[model samples]
Target: MCEANAYVRQDGVEELFLEGVDKVVPMDNQLYLENIFGQKKMIAGTIKELSLVDHKIIIEKI
Candidate 1:
């Protein structure tokens, strides 16, 4: 329940990228997102914001 949903901010809008994200790993200039269900997504981007209270993780694509 502590897990947060990840979003990608684009053109002044936030789009949901992943739900129940548990971890984020950065390697080889790419970001790896792992959800509670072990679903993974790798993308080229930078972390923009972490709103723990709101349970949101925002990323901006490179």
Candidate 2:
């Protein structure tokens, strides 16, 4: 239940990228996202916000 939904801010809009993201690791210049279901993704972006109450992880593309 600690996992949060990940979103990417594009053109001032927040778009859902991943659900149940449980871990985030920074490697090189990309961010690695691991979900509770063992799914993973790597993205080149900067963290914009962490809305714990809303369970949202917002990131902005660089």
Candidate 3:
């Protein structure tokens, strides 16, 4: 229930990247994201914002 949805922002638009993200790890130049369902993704971006109250995470591509 504490998991959050991740989004990628581009050109002022936000797109859903992943849902139910439970873990986030920064490795080198990429960000690693994992969901509660065992889903995983590695993205070349930086964190833009994290809204814990809204359960949202925003990432900006490099």
lDDT per prediction?
0.93, 0.93, 0.97
Runs of candidate 1 exceeding 4 Å displacement: none
* TM-score of each predicted structure versus truth: 0.93, 0.93, 0.97
- Candidate 1 lDDT by residue in tens digits, 1-62: 88999999999899999999999998876789999998999989999999999999999999
Residue pairs whose backbone atoms clash in candidate 1: none
Score candidate 1 by lDDT.
Answer: 0.93
Order the candidates by TM-score, highest first.
3, 2, 1
For residues 1-62, write the lDDT of model 3, one tens digit per residue. Answer: 89999999999999999999999999887899999999999999999999999999999999
lDDT of 2 by residue, 1-62 (tens): 79999999999999999999999997877899999999999999979899999999999887
- Candidate 3 or 1, higher lDDT: 3
Worst 10 residues of 1 by lDDT: 22-31
